[model samples]
Target chain A: MTTETTPARVTVGTGDPVLRVRDLQVSYGTPNGDVPAVDHVSFSLQPGQRLGLIGESGSGKTTMATALMRLTRPPGRIVGGEVLLGETDMLKLDEKGLREVRLRDIALVPQGAMNSLNPVMRIGNQMADAIEAHEGRAARKGMEERISAQLARVGLPPTVARRYPHELSGGMKQRAVMAISTVLNPKVIIADEPTSALDVVVQRQVMQTLGRLQEGIGSAVVLIGHDMGLIAQFADLIGVMYAGRLVEIGPVDEMLTDPRHPYTRLLIDSLPKLTAKGKLVGIPGLPPALLNLPQGCAFNPRCPYAFDRCHQDVPAVQQLAPDRRAACHLYPANPALPALPASVQMDAATPLELTGPAMEGQEEVAG
Target chain B: MSATPLLELRNVTKVFQSGVRKTPANMTVALRDASLVLPDGTATATAIAGESGSGKTTMARLLLGFIKPSEGQILYKGVDITKMDKAQRLAYRREVQPIFQDPFEVYNPFYKVDHVLTTPLRNFGLYAGEEQKRIEEALEMVGLRPKETLGRYPHQLSGGQRQRIMVARALLLRPRIIMADEPVSMVDASLRATILDELRKLVSEFGISLLYITHDLTTAYQVCDDIVVLYQGTVTEVGSVEKVIRDPQHPYTRLLVSSIPLPDRTQRWGEDDSAITEEQARRSTSGCRFAPRCARAMEECWTQIPPLFRVDPDRAASCFLRKDAPVLPSEQVGQVLKVMRPGDAGNAPAA
Candidate 1:
């Protein structure tokens, strides 16, 4: 079931990269000072590729995704960043140019499906409005058929288009939202915690629906969520974020099996296993406050491998391997510091077996 | 296990009526003939596992005396709670306390967080000279420092810290039973293990029986000793956590176990809508509540409700498939329920 609407202006060729974000920095303006929510974040998405951005609350993963679409509101400004959608610099575009780029080039499947749709409007009209806004009034002809085909692609019945948002279940509403977002066939789709509020069975169904749509449109997807297990299942590449910075980015298999960053390791270890055998230990202390971030590495206070240099100098993004990057003092890329012993490096690769009273007093070090 | 139960719910049922003019069609059955027993003289953790509309919260509220059951009795120490005297009720209130789901909503934002800990001590008249020591001890037990959490407001502390304070407040009363309703659902994944470990320690060290209610199957496996799988307020299966997870007898239990997304990368869930459709048929279904959704449902399952069939020496499931003999009438079902009591002698035929 394909929509009859013609494709909008195809700026980039099929083989080229869809989106690129270079050294993006976003800050929230507060009464005290500017809080750097996303500092020096850089990543790119190829056509039909899935990149999962994971982090705990207050980690600025949502802010980073919002900045990519140039949707960061007032008080939260894109202080420094270049969001490149194909050859176009998204940051430099005017409001009208950005509007044209939205839905035609990149679309957003918002966090809460309930709040995304207009409650007063019917589902079909809301979808038609999205199409009309992008494709103009003449494109609204035979809109019902296009809406139904898009809805059917996501496994929703055509009758759902006539119902109001409140008339549908949470899962149904989410599917409708997905259909509307992808009806325009955007090159890139950003789904922020798309299935976070759903039940387990429904969550899997929604994820499958999103996967099917992304495959159908051949759009690059940026899936942001906190569930590491869910992300590992769906995403091809995973990026771990902590306190607004990209701590580690690598292939999904490499990041899950042999994580280099201490924070990523802790996040994976914290997931409860199906079979209850050993005790799961959470990382002690809370995520650092963006307003009063600690000196040097932000994760140094909670990191178990902290040493002398970790307290003094901020770690830059260093290439750990061919396709992996980690920002940590332990993997110092420069030749200035002597390389750590092979035994110490091997210990970093293995999962830490935390026990006894060692976990206590770790929170006290975080000023 | 002791002969007397710390708490018991005998054939309890709750029906919530909606709309201005309440009719039979407007009525929603939250819980249906549900029975549970928490054994005395032991620190046991029993988890009531289910989805959103599974009536876990209703069961917790029924036990707490916040709402009375439409039918049947809730017993405390083998005595009906509704018939208790003023003095007995006060004692019962102290014995059964609740740890709510959201820590932030449980406390007021205007007051200091320590007020949650101090109010109970003051109300129970335990705020004496050693009040500070008791508060500090309770906080330490939950792995929170008194100095760090004493003067802060609800907004000042993290979600994990706020939840720990709630646990600390429960400890101050020295309660025998703690009803934690999805306590760690809102907490972060990293911090969930810490809170769960604290709840388990309370059972082991403090001899406090915990009624842990959650929709998360993984956490249920981690902390619960016994598990009760609730589907639309009906007890579909009940047994030791290991038995229920490893060898589930009921079809609903099998669906739930399979639906849990494990950390293992190899296993993937197949597309299935039977479980979801069964949940949607909850309000209108008659006979077996789970029949509409059960993959192995029979024709008789749509007309007659099934009784709890003993699947093992310790496990019981409400399913027609488990019944070897003829279906029993409602009167004979009472006899079956009596034998199914936690510490009762073996009076029924075992699987």
Candidate 2:
């Protein structure tokens, strides 16, 4: 392989991207065997930047995250392609080597953390176990003090280390989970809907903590969530998944403000706006099944801008604006691109109108 | 014809005393002197947003009368539901149905999707051949084609399909109001919009009032017309969805709106919540539930609780900053005040 295009041992956060996946495919095993879950998905993450992984249920976004964690098990396997973490290929790692990389090099805060916690374990002890498993020979000295500091970093008092999972509130437990996930200070963190089950207030707290922690440690966060709003704020760059494929990926502002893909545009416009009130319009159909994805673009059947080419060929993630890419047959490049259906870009209290008092004067620095 | 509300909670206060915790076991107050006026059977759902401890679920249970309030009353069409006997409560429940958050839990593992949808039919005495046709319509209403859905076990269907079935069951009863507590939170993302769209269709087409309780604000902002921001056992803000969201007057509401992941991060709509420290969370709390977290908190805010003040023709918020409380004259509402016990009816709860 040529040095320019081939893999090379370059320092992370400086040279090549931290992680790159090219046409990575995954699927489940049925009686018929091998149903595609992730269809030739491709995206790359830089060391200090975040890429939001989003999709509806059965979209395979979670499956992709699980694959990165190497947690994908029976009835599920990587069907194809490269999962490169630095110059070392991740998909190529054996089970044992993958384990080392999981906690020490990267970590995941699972969505099931809400219930996955062992009720009997003290919050601090559980964290200690994680630290010990990864810290290996060095875990003996200052582990307890380190654990206390980590808990405090996540907004939990050091005393929380003494309490069992059940004693803590749902939000607290999630925060504790975050603490353990980041305890190793891995280069990457994959959080799967970490705040989906939380209350609005606590959701904010957890997100702020996660955001701050990510910034402090300078780890690239793989925030997997369906809530467009959370993804909008947390993701520096976004990858909108539809039916196991990365339909769109770009800077957050570009994707949210001026969407190119029909599915991406549909997803943004479908979000309930305060001003939309009586005018809110939800997307018409469900996401296509992974086992039997629709022909051409997976989102074609549900897309308002689907043309003949969209229905015939799988749309590739093509660059639209600089640093912005979307998987659609229609765009500025394709002057003959079919026009999207007439839809309201803004609800009654459009985001444009939401300024000053509505934002509590946070608007000045908000944008 | 009078100014009576379609569904009203008049100073509703629910106190659940756990059987445990001796030495005057603390009672959990899900609601405290809460009240709201909902237009009868308005299709536009009213969103109740709050943090977990803010008691949004307790309010749902109160609205459904699943649990009785320790004090005050809940009125449906001007009739006191708090005082309703067991049989009366059952009839009231029929009119005010609930669609649970986890659609899978609503179904029996032993039965198929059809079985769960039909259970409400048999319980409500609507299990007839005509009910069969109604089932199809309800399924279609939730965007589920009956043939693809019926007979499938809860395990067989997708999360979105199961939730749709749950919505179908609620629709089957033709209930006047649907109490959905975080209904779509569990469903996968791609299908969330479809369910939300279906809920919108239910109101615009079916004219069913929806009390949508959730912690997510973007979805609420997308779907609801009016909203109430709940604090610790209290209503902090209540008014038009646009006003409360676009320009929240209450610090709590502003915090809540800002906490939400907005579609646009550049304009992430609220204050940085660093000010709401744990010490502030503990010591700053007083007359105003959010005084501890309010950046503009004043000393008087600690002395007396503010009442809900109508900020405009269609909105009301409970904050001294609004300064427009019109406490109903004791002479006017005193005669109609009610206090009732759930145990008085002695009707056995559903098995």
Candidate 3:
């Protein structure tokens, strides 16, 4: 495949993008058939830019992130797409090449501190393992010093290095995991729900630690989480996913404040505000199963403003504004296609009607 | 107001004795002098908001009569629940229903979802004729269709659907009070509002008092009329949700309020230096539990446990900052604990 570098208006450092993903497709082979977990997802990450992939469970956000690193397990395969990491097409790289790319180029801070760390190993041994695996065995002389330095960077006491995973608190373990992931200083870090399990105050501290670490390393971050509030606080750009597709991607402020997509609007509305006056209304139905997703737009069944076009035709991703794109019938690329009725156009000021036919437990499931 | 409360915990203090040989160090003070009342004849919702190990679970367990309080009496309609007979205990169980955090745990994976609804009906001897209609009505009340949710295994339904089914089961009992412990925590954010709305509707429409237990202040603010902020198992602040959230007097309450990541992008967490290390905060067992972490902690705050000082007529915060203020007696505080409206300052206590 020919590598085409699309010029982004808001480049990170005035050069080719640091990490560019094009037409990424990942599918899970179930007993019934092949289910497309991540279908035609594409996004670019500029150097040091924080892109938050916000979605509910089973929305394929995690699958897409894992697929980028080629870390997808059995039954889940990356069928298509180009994962270009600074001129290198990562998809084409072999096992040897991928290993080098994984540690040196991109690292992952997996979800849950408890599951991520090796229970039996000391914190120092875990850090050393990553460093030794990537930087080679000869670099062991200064490994202890490097580990302590990284630990301190994330606000963990250097004495914590000798302690086991269970010995440290949840917050400390989380910080240690972050330290280990960033010990090598990769170009991009993908932290998946790093603080979801922590308390609010502890979560704040962890987020602060992550922000400081990200700044110190100057690496592009792909933060995946279910919390829109946390994502809005941390991310510069936001991508909203629903049913194995990237519904919308734009600047975080613009996307959050004035989201074009109905799903994005619903997510924002669903969030219980500390300062809200009235009761919050949730989106009516569950997201469609990936195996038997609804025809045309996957979100049509749950979307309050879904029209006839949304039911029959898949909405192509259209550039709604500069540096902003959304896949919805409302924002059609073609001039001939009619936009959604003005009455149903959801905005911050207008409250959406909760009762709908779709909300009455009429879900279409495919066998 | 009635002289007797629907349910009440009088100076409840629970200590969990850990390990084979119990020691003072092993004894975890889950709750310390925690007192609250659920008023009868009105569908008032009070949120027990606290983080893990803050004793929200212990309080819930005490309310459910699963475990006896090490000290203090749990009164139901002015009767001590601890001293209740088997017959009285059964009645209490029927009236006070609990909705736990994980719906999957409440349900058996092998059994059909309908079993959850039918089991309660069968046990209560209400499954003679109108079982199907009653089940349908209960499901409808929680925004679920009987046809869609019934006869399906636990794995077939979503977390939100499963949780709603749990609520539907609770509704079947026709309980006077429903204690929902982190009901929406495991459910998706999109589905949380619907569950919360159902809980709120139960209060208004069905006149069922809800004891919403959660760590998330956002949901508590949305559904609850009153807020009880817990720190290290102690009631840090208990007042109208508006008063507690809008102008939090307790330092811990303020930290919790500010720490929540709002949807607004401009809002950022305070500097790291302002926050106490988690280890330090958790280790301190003396004085004000929040004193080590509190930015405004005075020397007196470190050595003295602050009493529940009345901030206003309807609001009380346990903080040394309000130490100089007039303290309302514990007995009087419970009687006058009316839900205050947004701007309804009946009488302003001098600060």
Candidate 4:
């Protein structure tokens, strides 16, 4: 594993570059067999940059995040992909190595992450518990100092560490979890919608704290959320996942200004603006289920631009520019199509049959 | 736009008495002397925006005619919903139906999905034979297929689907006023627009006035034209949504609007110093309740209970500052913008 320590680029390699996943395919082994929850996913991390994992539910964003910390539950195994950290691949690491990585190098702010903190236990005790898991030689006094430092770093008064989780507000609890997540100053931090439940003021403050903290430790951050606005603000790189596949990957500004995919355009256009006072022009259909994904492009069925060629062939990641990729046949070098009306979204119809044409005149892409 | 108001809350005051004695001893003033008039056709969608302890939900219950107001009357199409007796109340209820915040909460898990809508139509005597068109129309209105979903249970549908059915239930009655409370907050984002668009049709095309209650300010502004900002059971601000949200004069109103997280990264939070504090909320105020948090609090503001004073023809704010407002700060945004940093993007541009 080799990574360039560029301030802007997330090329992993330097001393267990926080987190790394390559061709990571995760699937649920149901009675029928394995259904890909995360199909051959790959990504890397860098210090201080927030990598936003954006997608609708069932797009495998959650599963992908869980796989990073080796926290995927039973029935869902990491079938493939090498998650490397420096010289060692996390998947190949023994249980003890995994334990060390989980605590020191990679800490997961788990999904439904706000409640991960014990409500009945004091915040100090919770942090201490995490510290005790790896606190072999540190004195009790040192641990206390670490706990207080963590609490203050997240903008909470030092005494908040002494309060029970229940005693704090929803925002406070979220902040406390953030406090615990960053205490050890791990190389990588994976936070799942850390500010989803918080109000705007607190939401900004939380992200502000994350940004400041990121700058302080230069820890590579993996932030997960549905709202693209938050992603655009914090994340340097944005990976748009759809139906268990990366539909579009690029720089935030690049994606926002010139989205190559219709789905990406629809997501941004659907955002109801205060200035534009009206019901949002939303994408016609709901996200496709990972269990029975459609042939060809998952978005082809609802896509207005889908012509004779859209339904048959699966479009691979086409690199339109440096660091920018789109899976739509209508990308750079491909013939252009008219801008589709995203608002023509009518009643929720049953899943439409995927019967469009091939991207390169090939067989059905739905298989 | 209509000559008469489709829905009206005339000095509506509702008190909830708790405890074994069921006394008014510790009655929660759910709504206090609230009054609003939504002229038919003119009022597209009206929003009741407030924080957790704010009386936004209580006002919704009143508008739905779920419970009688202790004082005052609720007028819908020249009729009082709260004052109506048994039979009259039932008939009147058909015209003013409620769509609860949690869609599944309104339906019985044992029954089919269509049962929720069909049951209401049947009760209203619009469920049989030729009336079948009404069922299909209701389903079409909410974007559900009657054939595909008629036999489905609540668990079978998504949160967005369940909520749409709830809206269809109200549509089945052909209600003039539809009271929807936080309908999309519990649902997924992709499906929210579908439901929101349907609500817009209720007012625009169908000509039904919508009393939409929500905490999400974005959707509130999107679907609603008028807004009622509630604070501790009082109407802190009320008027057309544009004037109220775009230029919030009330401290509580400003705080609530500012607290909502926007999807745009360029936006920053509006931190009005006047946003009432928790300590200020503990005890009721003699003057303006928000005076404690009001950045423009004056010596006179602390003593006199500020009456709802008109700022414009359609907008009003219950604050001493707006009542013949004196020399105010040139930079009025300082109160809110003080806490907001350059990079903290919560405020949308001037739009």
Work out the TM-score per prediction: 0.89, 0.83, 0.91, 0.84
Candidate with top DockQ is 3
**Predictions' DockQ, in order:** 0.26, 0.24, 0.42, 0.24
Residue-by-residue lDDT tens digits, candidate 4, A200-315: 54576667677667666778888887777667766777888877777887777677777778777777777766766754555665566555567788787667677666788887
Model 2 C-alpha lDDT per residue in residues B225-314, reported as the tens digit of each score: 667789888888776666788888787887777666667655653436665567666774448877887777777788788777656544
Poorest lDDT segment (10 consecutive residues) of candidate 1 chain A: A358-367
Count clashes in each candidate, considering only residues at least 3 apart in sequence or on different chains.
0, 13, 0, 18
DockQ of 2: 0.24
Model 4's TM-score against the true structure: 0.84
CA lDDT of each prediction against the hidden true structure? 0.78, 0.71, 0.80, 0.69
Give a tens-digit lDDT track for model 2, residues A256-358. 8777777777678667654454444556555554555668987766666666997789876777766777778775566433456468332211111101111
Q: Write the per-residue lDDT of candidate 3 for residues B1-351, one digit (tens) a residue.
A: 465778888889999988977887898889998888877666688899999889999999999989999998899988899898888888888889999988668889889988988987888677589999999988877877777677778777777788888888999999999999999888777787878888887787787888999899988888877888999988899878888988888888888988888888566655553345666555554788877777777777878888889887668998889987677555444643543333432222111
Model 1: how large is the Cα RMSD against the reference? 6.7
A best-first ranking of the candidates according to their DockQ comes to: 3, 1, 4, 2
Which lDDT tens digits does candidate 1 get at residues A3-65?
111222122124667898899999988897998989999988888878889987778888887
Between prediction 3 and prediction 4, the one with superior TM-score is 3
**By lDDT, is 1 or 3 better?**
3
User: Which lDDT value does model 4 have at B264?
Assistant: 55
What are the runs in model 3 whose C-alpha is more than 4 Å off?
A1-14, A333-367, B20-22, B273-285, B329-336, B339-351
User: Looking at candidate 4, what is the lDDT of residue B211?
Assistant: 79
TM-score of chain A of 2: 0.86
Tell me the lDDT of model 1 at B256: 82
